[model samples]
Target chain A: MSIARFSPFELLLLKSRSQVDTATLLLLAWVLVHRQHVSEGQRRRRLAQVTAQFRHGHELGPIMSIAHSQDLQAIQLAAEVVRKECSNERSLSALYQAITLATDDGDLSLANHYILRFLADLLNIAPSTLSTLFQELTGKPLCPPEDPSRDAYWQQHDPEYHARQAQEAQAAEQQAKEAHARAEQRQRAQTEKQQKKQQKQQQEQQRQQEATRNAKARAQREQAQREHDQHEQARRTRWQQEQARQEEARRRQQHQRSSSPPPADRTTRALAVLGLAPGASRTDVRQAYRRMAQLHHPDRFYSESDHLVALASARFQRIKNAYDYLMQTY
Target chain B: MRDLYQRLALSPSANSHQISSAVTHCANSALRQDAETVLGVAEHRDAYNKLHKTVSDIGQLRARLGLTHGAHWQGDVANDFSLPPDNAISRHDELVDRVSYAVSLYNHWRRFKGPLLLVALFTAGAGIGLAFGFTLGLGLGTR
Candidate 1:
């Protein structure tokens, strides 16, 4: 694996192409450098990291196909196209992204070196420039040490390396602790937020229940009041009806009493018809009748006009009827 | 009959000569006839006097009882003694009653017309929909 450093101009040149072309070129360069040296999983992870870092708007499917391809000619052609189309600065930036993908697992193998060297050569970059860029990105010489006992030489002469390692180990431990503490804090905040939300929901439910209960009670009270009013109105109506009925009865009784005349006996009427007092004798009745009959006799008025004769006849008949009644009673 | 004497302008104790003179002078033929029937005989005169006295007593009693008019009584006495009775129902009253009844009927129809129209429209629409659906279904089935 190797790391490559990019200049600002080289980064800008790399991004200047259409996003799909840049992404395809980047993926092709990555496949060329990492296919031989890295495992498939490591290559995929590094490809993801490089793509994310570049923020390229490319789908993963076509890029994954490029990474899986074993066609060396296609890879070489893609490299040549990138070299011809882009400036040397853009080509270097694309090569640096490929180197970043290869070196993200933290080591530069001989296979990664050969493929990257091949890509640099195809891009028309000099070996020295490649070595210099690799050195700048990884902080090491591009080639391995010549001594076969490389570890022994570093262990004997570079004590600071071991110190730096220990310092890095300590720094990693501190970062892990901080990350754990942050995780616990996030969890605690989340739990508190959930509890507050639950409490709010419970309060809302209680308020809704209270509102429902109040509505129900109010409805019931209103119903009761309405019923009471109806009953009161009904009672009042009945009372008014009763009062009116009694008044009608009293009025009817008064009308009956005032309208009906008192009874009169027929006997008094008959005695009056005979022109006799209540205590008058049969002789008095007869005398009154004879006096009336003689004055009104039809034969005596026969010589007068016919109207006078008719009037005398009716008068004479009444006198005779009264005399007969008096004679029978006496 | 009780007023026969008053009709002839005669006293109860008048002799036949005075009664005949009054009857001959009476202007109304009906009055003359009533006078002749009531006053020509002693018994008839007595009967008229008795009936008159009874009616006068009743009228006095009603006045004491605070009945302002004899018309309040459901009796022939009111008809016989008071002014002519007025007709209870008039053509105008009958027309008013008929118009009011018709107006009430119109109001009832107005009150119910909207709901009735809605119901009729709903029924008609449902019927049309059902017929259309049935015909379409039959055609589809035959096909």
Candidate 2:
């Protein structure tokens, strides 16, 4: 390679100690030089030139030693120059074609990925975009297949995690159902207690209302009874007053009849009924009438014989009349 | 016997003007010195009241005798009723004199008013400083 062209690739391989073989070097050089052109004649001429320059075994040792001697700053400067030169699609297409040719069995190996990653970084291509390009060019997966050592770890733990999660979900479901049942029971008990309390309060109010009504009825009955007793007493009093008036009238009539002494022809009969003399004053007639009443009153005939009672009644009548007549004459 | 005129610091034959002026001067001096509280000690107020009653009595007696000036006099009453002797009158007079003396001394010392104010300010500042230092010490000790 020319000093100007070799400097950048030297920078890209600065940290790589594994030496590139003659075939890979020639192939990489041919892809870089020939695929940049479109004509078949120009591609053949460039491929011959790259093969003739680095075909010898002795040339690779010097080239690799010189690449190793370049410092990080020099490498970076050379990479910048190369990135400006090879930023187009043409150079990237050439790199993909070269990587495809370098891979054995049409599938990328670890060493192939390392080389592709290194070149893609220098070329300002994203790692993921480069991986896709590598797969497209090589007709294989960008990453290597997982070894059984790594796969065995996941295979051992995946079912355990799934089973644990299923168990946890079942427990949670059971717990939720139990909690719901308990809450329902508690709610039912609370409702029942509230209903009982309400019923008790209603009964208490009913009892109070009944008692109030009973008290009112009793009061009314007592008032009616009191008024009835008062009326009865008044009726009795009126009856007694009427009876007393009747008795007084009867006594006055008897007195009037006794006072006149049956029109006596002489004053002697009248005086005898009165038990007074013919010349008696009004005082003697009154005294004799009072004495006759005391001895032969109707009130004193309770234990007497029937004939004696009649006799005393007639005598009293006569004595009363005679006394009244004497009082008038005097 | 010391009479009412002696208690009022006037002659017995002095006119009303002399008696009023003496009373006014004594009362003004006592009030300025705040002597009412001093007189209120133990029996001092009682003594002063007694002196005041005696002066009032004598003044009334003189006025009544004067009102009957042109009228026919009843009898000779001058030598019959003499004023009673009283130690309270003298004691009250002495107390009033001492109060006046003390008031005069207080007014004289009032000339150093500015220095007294400075001394008061300094005392207040020192008290504040002492309190601040004590608080600072307590805070440091707790820490």
Candidate 3:
């Protein structure tokens, strides 16, 4: 970068006589476009110097043809050839410096901007890297070489065109990230909802099963109670009927005993005194007593002789004695 | 010793009707105060029987003598004992009717014995069957 130590122009003069390759031709064009002279005499002196250098090497015709060409074809062709020869970082840096100086202007031309982009493409340098190189060479901001909204040729020729293509690329990347995040959130929420629904269904099923089991148990208990009550009722009824039968039998036995006759014995002898049979019943004995007492009662013989009443009373007394003995003994 | 006729307040030569009437009168006098007493009535009845037997013996001797004197006995033989009163006979008939009613009731019981036994058996069987059925139903229901 120091003019006193090493100059691009002097370097070109040294390589001029050795070969007239595309690198040597590009160096010459770079010097013609970027170099400044204090006076016309200075410009004339440099031109003479370059011409003499090519004439001494007997390559003046080709060099002069390139210098006098009114198009950027030679510059484009030179850039292609230099791209092959200069692949190292130092050579790329030197080429970047030369392009920067050639394109530098208070107001840049469309032809110069096109030639710069064409050279950078051949050299496989990114447009952004070229901007960084431009800043390094001129200590100023780099102008991007794209603008689709304008006329394609006009944007290339426009000055003060330093816009960023990086913002658009970053925005596309951020949008993709946001879309992916939203999709993941929706998937997670759906999975949680499905799990909750399944859990609720399982709980409902369990409750139903429990309720059914309880109902079955209750029904069973109620049925058992009813049956037990029925069985108890039957048992009570049977017991009551049996009791009634026993009472009936006892009543009949009592009636028979009271009505039946007494056995023949000392009581039977007494019964005979009342004109009853030997094996007479207790009822017969009472009947006999009533009969004899009525017949031989003293009142019956009151009107008759004393002897007759005495006889009736004696007989009645005998009957009464027998009746008493029979009743007491039996 | 006092004679049997004297005990009955009769003369030794009295006829059978006169002797029987006189004996009844004497016995009635002795039994009238305590006729309801068993011991008194028994004692009176025993005395009357003994007197009657002795009087009959005396009468038989007298009858033999009378027969030698050409006297015939003309009294009915049934006149010696008295018949029971009509009310006594009616009481006896009433007793017979009661006994007959009791007999009829017993006969009715005998005639219906088979059906009554069958009813009792059916009741018992039905009770047992109902108990068993209820027990089985309860067991199954509980299970």
Query: What are the models' TM-scores?
Result: 0.25, 0.22, 0.22
- Which is the leading candidate under DockQ? 3
Candidate 2 residue pairs that clash: A258-A320, A258-A321, A259-A320, A259-A321
Off by over 4 Å in 1: A1-42, A53-57, A144-330, B1-143
Relative to the true structure, how large is the alpha-carbon lDDT of every model?
0.58, 0.50, 0.52
Per-residue CA lDDT of model 2 for A13-39, tens digit only, reads 333332232323433543232122235
* DockQ by candidate, in order: 0.00, 0.00, 0.04
Model 2: docking quality category: incorrect
Candidate 3, RMSD to the unseen true structure: 83.3
> In Å, what is the interface RMSD of model 2?
68.2
Lowest summed lDDT over 10 consecutive residues: which window, candidate 1 chain A? A145-154
Cα RMSDs, all models: 65.1, 61.9, 83.3
Pick the lDDT winner. 1
True contacts kept of each: 0.00, 0.00, 0.13
Task: Assess the local accuracy of residue A232 in candidate 3 as a C-alpha lDDT between 0 and 100.
Answer: 100
Model 2 per-residue lDDT tens digits across residues B77-117? 22112233432222223333555666677987798778989
Write candidate 3's Cα lDDT for A164-195 as tens digits: 33466678999999999999999999999999
